[model samples]
Target: MNKKLTLSLDDQVIRKAKAYAKINNVSISQLVETYLGEVINDDEPKLTGVVAELAGIIPDQEYDKMEYLQNKFS
Candidate 1:
């Protein structure tokens, strides 16, 4: 289920958010929605366990997985 929302934000914040959303390939609405959902649900602290600690041990990455598999199988 989805609902439309209207928010009041500062000009600079809106501009920066738009720039970040564009770079991250998501809509500003999506970025805000994801953030709000995370905050409301309070999921961050669950990552304190050992397995969760390993999550950041690897640096973030973007990969073309399909291309890699195709080349490997070619």
Candidate 2:
């Protein structure tokens, strides 16, 4: 049992979505359905104890991965 949905989107977004759907061999409706399902089903596991306590202790920062790898391996 499915219902029709009307969406208002930019023309460029619709064009891109159509191309993506065609390449993936799915209808635009299916793509939207799958995305909505994932978003609605937010069932992520919760960390506990030490892991939960340590989470977010470090401030968000970006570092050069290549530099770290070269220093580590070379």
Candidate 3:
């Protein structure tokens, strides 16, 4: 179920948020929803189903994740 939300924010903040949301390929509503969900959920990113399955594929080995990603992409 989705409900309508009305927020009052600074003009500059709204402008920046709109630009940020557009660049990230999501609606401002999604951005707000994600932010609010994280805050309400104590900032833990909980994954489930297919995402959890794929996330667990990598072995729990001592490795630099950023370096691995850089090497993989580069």
Candidate 4:
């Protein structure tokens, strides 16, 4: 089942969306539908137990993954 939708968007945005749809071989409606579907269905997984407790314990920062693995395994 499909329903018709009317949207008011900027002219430049509409042009860009049409160009993007054409390049990707999909209709603008399809892009909008997919985006809306993702938005509507977006759900974050619920963490539990120790994992939940550890969440955000480490401050967000960049680290060398190779060094970390080498230290862990070697």
TM-score of each: 0.56, 0.59, 0.57, 0.61
Q: Tens digit of lDDT per residue, candidate 4, span 1-74?
A: 99899999999999999999999999999999998887788797667799999999776997888998999999
Best by lDDT: 4
Clashing pairs in 1: none
* Cα RMSD (angstroms) for every candidate in the order listed: 12.3, 10.5, 9.9, 9.6
Pairs of residues clashing in candidate 3: none
- lDDT by residue for model 2 (14-72), tens: 99999999999999999999988877885996677999999997657977879879999
Return the lDDT, model 4, position 10: 100
Better of 3 and 4 by lDDT: 4
Model 3 lDDT tens row, 17-52: 999998999999999999888879885777879998
- Span of 10 residues, lowest total lDDT, candidate 4: 38-47
Ranking by TM-score: 4, 2, 3, 1
Relative to the true structure, candidate 4 has a C-alpha RMSD (angstroms) of: 9.6
Q: How close is candidate 3 to the true structure, as a TM-score?
A: 0.57
Query: Cα deviation of 62 in candidate 1 (Å)?
Result: 38
Model 1: lowest-lDDT 10 consecutive positions: 43-52
Q: Give the TM-score of candidate 4.
A: 0.61
lDDT of 1 at 69: 92
